[model samples]
Target chain A: MQFQPADVVARASFRLPAADSAEAAVRTCRPLQDELRPLAVEARAAGPDEPGEGFTVEFLLKLPAPQSDDVEGVLRTAAAPLLARLGLDAGKLDVDVEDRDAIVWAGDEALSKGGTACGAYVVHLRIGRDPDEPHELLPEGSLTDEEARALTETLNSLFEQRPVEEH
Target chain B: MSTPAWWDELMSVSDALAAADRAEVAYWRGGAEDGREDSHEDDVPPVTLRLAALGREFASHAHELTAEQQHRFLGVLEDVLRTGSEADGTAVATGFFESLLNAWNGGFDLQAAWAGVGAESQACCLDLNQFWGIESPEWMLPRVA
Candidate 1:
């Protein structure tokens, strides 16, 4: 199944050390535009709010399946130089990747059974955060049965169920 | 006009959806004559006022909504956003309603989302803080004051 361009959305927020100003945050993040320029469909950095706690930078990329495995690594690697430039600690960064293709697969499954998929086809993954949010179905069509099963297995693996406690 | 008892019954997904629809219609009616000299004494649209009331009410009773109700409400909200985007002219009331929907979604700190809603509303020349009776600008943004 062919995926659309810009189907992958990667968002990263960096919380600067307490004393950082909005100007400093922007200056630190400005290098990312040059680093991600080649891979991005669209990219932007939202300036830090007045308190200067943090700021966010987002990228929409048209990555093919072969490059999927290295997404997080690429994100971290791209962010590293910027962090080093700003003398910011890596621990303060939060990264999230949304796989629109997986949502498309889920949506197709729903639509095949005559169910409607609402809104946009997007799957939000907060990188290191717990997976508790309900997944939404993407709008339908495409993907082989084998591919669908594999993707389903991958998604299912992300959420581990805890054993129930007996009273 | 007195608030309907059905408004309190909005814990049901179906009722919530119906309330949203009714609120949208009422908002449009009020917004239609917004700048006219003959506009009603209550300059704020009934939908905007009702949604703000609903936001407060829903926040207090949010836990009462079933998981299914929360999921369905999110879906309904996405539809509302889609409809708002497709309209020839986006309405400030729509942004206000979106803020209420985000508040109802809960779980995350909604300051940033609220800020975006406020910015969108003001871009359309509506002062959400004044209309919603909000005092702090920080409440609209993600920053904690």
Candidate 2:
């Protein structure tokens, strides 16, 4: 699958342990953003909270699509080294891969069915905490039954649209 | 003072891996004593079962493994793969490895699987580049076309 620069968005969130200070966490993550700069249309790091205790560093990346079919490989290749550098514990890091096209398709399908037109669909296809729940299409609150049906149909169609490869 | 369920599951996986290791050793030793290459017909089933159990246990409780424990688990898995390679061949070893990998990956939450076995443990368990036959860092390069 190919992606237009706008079509794919990659986010990596590094949730540091309570023992780690925000400055230290940002120090660890800054270089990662630098390293990722060449690969992403935009790469950024968001922080250890100013007043709060939690420390989280995030990278928001945009890349052209027909992106690799190996989305997992792409995300791992980018975040693994950075995570190792931080010496973060298991379950502390999260990476999200979103297909904007799929999100738009679902949203438009929902709108077509009489749902309120939200500005943009923030489809969180993957989240760190609830990794097992497949296809979390968001703008999360409540969906009209017709809107939900349309969204589901849109998702199913998107799945069917993937290119079949010979084993 | 009670152990967490995840820890219990990890212990079960460790036990299963140890049992599989012993079975493999015995299978090889028996073949050597008989001065014959073992067909491994009898050995495969039990070992497979144990590996499957290990995979299931890991899938359910991978997040529970301490960093040290994760390293130890990876080391044991490497040993299994190495032994399988030496005894049977790369094909057999690779097949065994892939099966276990699939089961382990399948057992996890989808996001975890997609995120992969965390950065620290990834190199020890499987090299994504080598596994996918993509060059390192270069694969991350965006395509202009």
Candidate 3:
């Protein structure tokens, strides 16, 4: 089976630190923007309840997943360059397959305890989503490379969290 | 006291969104515990899709909202996050607004969803974001207890 162009697309979104300016956020994401492809980059000022949220950025990158099973592999490839640019300390990265039927991240890491089932393809890479305010991101020494890799594995498994489907 | 019509609409929007999440929680719990299958009847779209549509709807109408509407919106969320309705000294689940705010600031990328929707609607979302922020400086993250 082959995936449609839509299925190959995913969006990554996160907020920069509250200290950064909106211009910096846009400039930072500029390298990922491509006019010829499905890639889209956007940055906008945030509305913090207090002040100093700075900005948020989102990128819709189209992966080369011509085959249905190529989804996970493409996602992994996409993540490396993105993380290298956005860096791990950026914030919580939420990536969701544009396809309607993909399994998603409902903020639950595990299944409901029976066997396993999947929903849509949405994953929240917990960089700094825990802070009560935008001013406090990831805290200090909060995230590790190993944990990010593990979370990426969990997101890769479309059917179950058993393991990253060896595609 | 009677609530304004917009308040009711906002309530419905938030309630339906909450109900969707609650249903998802139930589906996960129900399907796993007893091995029951997913209901074929509720063939709704993904929660984010539904949320995006509803949020866009809110944004379009947001500019028309009055101060009373804003007060009610802020008051209800504040009451939940601040004092909260308690039963037997146990606080209720107030994740609806927190989750909604997270949509604005957290992982959901709501503003991205509104891309090309229009400048006014996007402006309204930002206004709501600022409103929530100023009204509750502790608005971004979900509150515990």
Candidate 4:
């Protein structure tokens, strides 16, 4: 089966290792950002929240696949390179796929076979906090803005730390 | 006895045929062996052996397979890759064999590609060289990922 386009995004928060602010974390993640780009995939970064106080990132991925099911495994595979490049280890990666079959073609055989006839195939993905995992401070009711920020900060710090001794 | 060109082609074809048989066997074995239809027979040793044979044949006749067969082979590879990603490894592998059979029957130069591969690990390289149309198995190429 041919794969349609795919979109993937992951968000998380962690404190900076030496730095006290989210800016440094943002900077660190910046260089590694392009690594997340899938072939024919677009990527954008949004907010550490409150002008620049907390670290919260959102990634968007688009892939070329016929079904939503086509996006997941590719997204997962893409994550490995990002982790290495960012020097950031993920506490949680919330991956989501959206089949953006907004338009349909009138004459395409694929459309007859159930694929959208027109417009680009799209898959939207989001990965962030996991409510199931217990947190020390946050009372879970979905991550509040502040809680999400805190998590982002923690992730930043964890990722920013130096690698251990390699013999 | 040193391998002859026809012998190689026949071997490759036989392998493709065997892979088809294994895939059928795997489908049938799925329910009873795993209890949940969890097994993917495509990746099984038998199927891989079959894909290897086709790869050897493709290698042998690289020039012949380079024709329109290249595109068709790429299509099959994509299917194999996608299925392998979603389903069990064996099932995905088997899917490639099934696809290879389709390409072979369709008149693609599967034997040439299989034959071109060097004797050493030519069989093992079928899955690996799937894209450039070299050592790749006729079952897998042009993968989406």
DockQ of each: 0.03, 0.01, 0.03, 0.01
The prediction achieving the highest lDDT against the true structure is 2
**How far in Å is the alpha carbon of A90 misplaced in model 4?**
35
Q: Please provide, for model 2 over A56-157, each residue's C-alpha lDDT reduced to its tens digit, 9 standing for 90 to 100.
A: 433334433344556555544444443344333223333444532211112334323322131111222222222212455575569999999999999899
Pick the TM-score winner. Answer: 3
TM-score of each: 0.24, 0.23, 0.26, 0.22
Candidate 3 interface CA RMSD, Å: 16.6
Q: Candidates sorted by lDDT, descending order?
A: 2, 1, 3, 4
Task: Classify candidate 2 by CAPRI docking class.
Answer: incorrect
Candidate 3 stretches with Cα past 4 Å from truth are A1-7, A18-24, A32-38, A45-52, A66-74, A77-167, B1-145
Q: List model 3 lDDT by residue over B10-85, tens digit each.
A: 4643444345434543442345423346533233222222233434333444445454554454444344334432
The TM-score ranking, best first, is: 3, 1, 2, 4
In model 4, the Cα lDDT at residue B79 comes to 41
lDDT of 3 by residue, A1-167 (tens): 12243344444544454324333453444433422122334344444431225455444444443333454444444444444443332133334333222222223332121111211122222111211112332334556888778767876885564756787
Fnat, model 1, is: 0.00
